[model samples]
Target: MRQRSSAEHRDLCALAPELSESLVAWWEVHGRKDPALKPWMFRADGRWPAPEEALDPYGIWIAEVMLQQTQLAVVLPYWRRWMEVLPTVEALAAASLDQVRLQWQGLGYYSRARRLHDAAQTLETQRWPRSLEGWTALPGIGRTTAASILSSVFNDPLPILDGNVKRVLARLKAHPRPPARDDALFWSWSEALLDPLRPRDFNQALMDLGATVCTPRQPSCTLCPWRLHCVAYAAGDPNRWPVTDASKPLPFQVIGVGVVVNAAGEVLIDQRLEEGLLGGMWEFPGGKQEVGEAIEATIARELREELAIEVQVGEQLIALDHAYSHKKLRFVVHLCRWIAGEPKPLASQQVCWVKPQSLSDYPFPAANARMIAALIDHLRADTLSQLS
Candidate 1:
């Protein structure tokens, strides 16, 4: 929305030419050579066979979604697996939620996977988004994501301001305060420095520069191509350029997880609603530890409340710690024997009794997954002892 003649635009105009030229040239040599960005867009000869070929929008959209709040290194394998499994938007749309969740089991943010499926269905009804506005209108696609997709796939000359780009721009300007305070300035600066001729390569180069060189910790300024143009480097403190806000203590919760198993060795699991954190995933039926209640009592209460059934809470199975983005969790997993009544989905979307061996087919959160591992190990050892 910012015009090139604006005052903020004028401030960056003088540096824009040199910045874009130098940055793109540097990218030619140091830019990430990974095909993760758009593997389908390249050829075996290392050059684009069809330079004008429209990129696979589905792949671009998937990569952008996976990359949100996640590092590229962590996303690479998941991206590869996803592409192999759900190569087309229509395939993703047709895939069951359970299958999608299984593929995204360890990806931390389960909501992204949900939105990806939702958006894939939406794309089937409509068409693959060709413009930034169209892309952002889809679920989970924000301005940065939309811009990245549009630029890389459509060569739309759109500017992106992801975490990496924000850090790079903030340091380039030597912003003494958090860039979030003046988002307009950072966005405008990113636009001013965008190279329209090669938007895809230019944006990728900028992201790589920030991720590899202008890191959050000690930046490799000496090897950086933009060191001479960086206001932060000139000020002798690149790390201080993007001013950091005071950190807040993350609140912690004590959870009680029940590994309820029947005589048939089937475990009780519940499906979370498709809304909040870890939505649409199956988990061992349990809840937060209530105040003044013992861990065992908490498990009994959670089972009674969550499922319309009573249980006898047994010994502790596993005690593990997990940290989410906003809260830390201390999960005290307990073995349990199902008793009294039949289990039903009282507070969850659904409930099921699955065999221990088939638990891998259902998607569970990281914390619940750990509990499953412990349960499997205990069951395997018990079987061995009986055989011996």
Candidate 2:
């Protein structure tokens, strides 16, 4: 753990209490009259029907789970897929662990996906449990996950203690109190302080406000509803507040392999089997890069290692940028013409050459999608240039 500077400590330390005051008032003014926003809600202006069926429980669950260490923008696609595949507890409960894994293939944190599967199965078999406690008993249904589910599905106003919300509150209170990574302390603060009457709306507002206006990098203080009450903003060092810095030195690696092919215009792709790092997905042949080796050489080496085939590295295509939960990746795709040797799966699981027309038959890793598109584009352009 990196040590926080004294000034940074001061900024973060006051975030919590400050946040509590500000958000409370903000909620009082802007809070919805939806019980779905709170525990057992009320109706001031007949707003009860508004939160009926949040229609986004699955998206909310997937978002919270995928957001473990990932960014908001990056989680969108994965969330959309999860939504389409398993929109509700009932749908998710019916899904197999393997199917869930496939749907959540690129979302990282495989355990969350697995837990969701188990929880879904449990949800299906067991009776519809009402309280958050009952929901929490299911696998992967943490306090935040349960809150999101209840708020989105049942519109129960349970305080959602997500990271963005924690950061917002921590900064608002100028809290020097260290936020436990597992979110225990934050959960306590959130639940206790949350006005159960509008837990759902308040939590969602906090999350949205934090992600958008009360941002980590550059907060839009002028537009914030809680601007008047924010102590962190008053401290003139909002960014330093919630001094949570578990920075990891990004590990760099290289992948070298060809979009292998046969004379029939079929491309050979391998379904990655490695667990925990973009597992169970197909990719155009390649693996990690070595020091001091040119990308072309690395490509040849990777082909020999993974596919056991010799290839003449041709021209270099565009570079594809990709980032997983744990590491960053830069894939330098190359145009390669086959040299020799029959295709044999050595490092990868199964290897096959499906025609370009039938490329959609296999499931490739999300990172490889760009590379595959680039590969096809490169081929098309080369053919056009030749014809010209």
Candidate 3:
């Protein structure tokens, strides 16, 4: 752990008690209490439970994992749907990976779902972890996630350093560098400030403070509980703290997608290999377009190479851009007529031909989901024309 100056540590210690008290008091009134938004935190009466009441650890685990790199509003529906289906560890362990992926369809980070499934299976054979080390041992349960779950469930007094807490801490102390640079220092600060008796509420308050008041942009310092003691607020530039590293432009690639339809009117889709990006998800046959290759030609070539089938690429179905965390992709999709060779999974897990409407039965990446909608619309239009 990176050590801060002795004077800095002394100052942090001096204000830790008051900071925790003020934040927790503020949170009781302003913290997220909506039953619809936080079903895990409320009772049947749609009110917060008594402080001594226990929360569902399983639900807390699921929400924390889903909240990683995803916002709360977007995660609410998915979390509710997931809980409806696989409400317990045993249910999740028993569910197939395909079913799990289906539940996590629109969630961009597919690996998190996979890891949760794996962890659940592991837990099915053993007891739920009670300690920080025990929880961290589970797949995809990092220190912060493990701590958050433990503190929320067991009141373990384990401080969290999630994105929200990091920003809050960085601004509170007027950090000179990006919070990512000295994780140890931030963790130390978080630990020092944690309210041991009210670890659960204190941690929740810290995250809420950052998300609502000490926000990354245009923070409402006047509304902040710690504004009087916050270093950055005193400096008159809260946003200027938590300095960010320069970002590089994401590399862009043009993908050529072939929506090959057989004479029987079934479209070809394949499951990606259970490795690498978007693993285990189904997608239309496609590959990156090489330099100087016409998009149509690229589509035909990709179909041949990927599925071991030839196709006559035709009119464009849709052209859409999708950005992932690391890179950006522009998918150029086109309608195609299958020409030769039996469709085989040459570079994928498997290939199958299904009615366009049946495409919904499979789990696809977000971009491919858009393509399916377009394809379905196109097919519906064509059917109406023929009927007329």
230-349: candidate 2 lDDT, tens digit per residue: 678899988877876677878777676577666677777876664555555567887777888888889899898777888888777667777765677888877677778888878666
Ranked candidates, highest TM-score first: 3, 1, 2
Predictions in order: lDDT:
0.84, 0.68, 0.89
* Residue 314's lDDT in candidate 1: 94
**TM-score list, all predictions:** 0.93, 0.75, 0.96
Per-residue lDDT tens digits of candidate 3, residues 260-328?
A: 999899999999998899989999999999999999999988888878888898999999999999999
Candidate No. with top lDDT = 3
- Give the range of the ten consecutive residues with the poorest summed lDDT in model 2: 33-42
Model 1 pairs in collision: none
Q: Give candidate 2 misplaced runs (Cα > 4 Å).
A: 1-124, 127-141, 155-157, 181-183, 246-248, 338-345
Candidate 1 — worst ten consecutive residues by lDDT sum?
Answer: 42-51
Question: Please, what's the RMSD in Å of model 1?
Answer: 2.7
Off by over 4 Å in 1: 1-9, 36-53
Q: Compose the digit string of candidate 1's lDDT tens values, residues 1-388.
A: 3352265457677889888999888877877755655464454455643325457677778878888988888888888899899988889999998899998999888999988998888888887777778888888899999998887777778898988898988887776667787787788889889987887878888988988888989999998888887878999978786887997999999999899989898889999988888998999988899789999999999888889788899989999999998999999999999987888888889999999999999999888888988998999999999999
State the displacement of the C-alpha of residue 379, model 3, in Å, after optimal TM-score superposition.
1.1
